[model samples]
Target: MSNLSKLEFVALDISGKNFLPWTLDAQIHLTAKNLGETIIDDNETSLQDKAKAMIFLRHHLHEDLKREYLTIKDPLELWNNIQDRFDHQKLVLLLKARSEWIHLRLQDYKSVSEYNSALFRISSELKLCGDNITDEDMLEKTFSTFHPSNLILAQQYRERKFTKYSELISCLLVAEENNKLLLQNHQARPVGTNPLPETNAISTRSKHGRGRSGGPHRGRGRGRGRSNTWHRESHNTKIDGGRGSSRQNTGRPHKGRVSGDKDNICYRCGMSNHWSRTCRTPKHLVEAYQRTMKEKGKQTETNLIEGAPNSSSPAFWSDTHLEACDFIENVRDV
Candidate 1:
């Protein structure tokens, strides 16, 4: 009595697979309504074409389809499950075909998820063989090499139900430790089997003969004794007496010395002993020179002003000359 199309019923039936009941009558009704003929009498209909037709029907009845019948939102998640199933089926087929060894070479992964995914894929693929090896055993064999993180992850995975990709890093840590041990064990031994003449482990005298070379002599207590002798001599009366005499005679005229009187006034300008060049009295010649400079500066400034279009007025020249005169007078006073 339901007005639902026949293709919709067929899609629902196909999508449900063997879990759901398939009614030939309902399928024929759907084929008849949509294709204008019954497909139940088909002769070797391809599953691909059937799947495509089902997809078309599913799209047409998308709103009617339940969430359970829909594919996973993430293609990768869907692919992971699909790949697991495919790998299992493929491995079984390969074994049936009598392929001796099932080898799977995995690509390097940076992320933990990538590693987990790859491991999951490999483990799932290997599971198809139904060999004596268990999932835990396969994981252990795959991660036999020592990597720090991988080792920890492997232990964790064994204790826990899930295997993580972090276990692969164990090999790297193990290799590092091995290299460190190798370096530590590498010793530079003397070439000759017989040990070299055993010299005194604690020699009182140095290898260099005492006083033979210009370098300091090396004998027990010699250096310390010499240092004490030098120290004593340095502070003794004999050393102090000579130093005291040099200091006492430094700025004082010794016996038979005559002292001259200091000058009272400058020589060059007949001023204070500070000297004529440095006298406080201002030189008229400098003032004359400055005056000449000011006059020249004024003339140059006047010429510059006269040349400027903005200073064409007579008042500008009168004001400029007055400013120049004031500057000259100020200098003269200084």
Candidate 2:
């Protein structure tokens, strides 16, 4: 066997039972040969058959492995024809392993080869054709390019959308710091220098009256002069107005006689001090008045209680006296 065949045999041996079956391999090769003959002879095969053959080869062994077996010089050209052959999960797992291995080597050696290898592995495994780029850029682009449903799935895994670029950068910086701490005994340089003093700083005055613009005589002397003038004018005006009004009202002569003079008496009550309206009397005055009136009417056969000489008798009471008694009774009830 050739060196390449020997290598394939060794790879199959290492893979053990996980490797493709001999019978499946024969069938795939025969199918490929027939398909090739039909293409060369210009004989059309149904798209369905082509799809079925592709599925059969992919299930048995991936397109890349099949191309390796065919010893294709330019395998990338066959990538499209073989992409539908493999299990997507298996491809993703292989790509993930390759990506992680390349990333691990990146810390030791920063090389374009390592980066390209990682990219090619990831793109091939993901069946990603267009827009393959740097892993960091690719991850961001892929996250951005997801369909709504796929984005929701990614959110479930990542716990949030790809917003907060600053926060993400901060987290990355903190992670880098933690890694450095682990490797360097937790020591780090301080971030920045202390700030310089401002050039236009002002000195505060220590004494209360030291900084006055007019040297202490300025505000107080001017303020007192204005205040005294205003106060004198206001006080004089008030005093003059009060005296004038009092003199005008009091200069008029007294009218008739004072209301409570000794010679006068209440017309309704024969009281000496108060008028009839203000005289105090018992509450039963109305009933007593009615009874007296009724008695007078029987005796005189007329409503002559006011003009009768009997009304002036010593036992006779006045209407004002009755009213005073009623007022006293109301006060008692309250």
Q: Where does candidate 1 stray beyond 4 Å?
A: 1-108, 128-133, 148-334
TM-score computed on alpha carbons, candidate 2: 0.18
- By summed lDDT, the worst window of 10 consecutive residues in model 1 runs over 228-237
Model 2 scores a C-alpha lDDT of 0.42
Candidate 2 — which pairs collide? 58-85, 280-324, 280-325, 281-324, 281-325, 281-326, 282-325, 282-326, 283-325
lDDT string, candidate 2, 221-298, tens digits: 434423111122221222222222111234455443343556666554444665555545433554575576567646
State the number of backbone clashes in model 1.
Answer: 11
Q: How does each model score on lDDT?
A: 0.42, 0.42
Residue-wise C-alpha lDDT for candidate 1, range 1-334, written one tens digit per residue: 2443334443332233311122333344446645312233333545554453444434433253435436644322322333343343444543642332233222244443444455555554344444444555545545553256566855754565446434444543465568778777564433333333533322121122223333366456544333212122221222222222212234443454232323556544444445454444445544665576567645433444445434778866766655466658566665
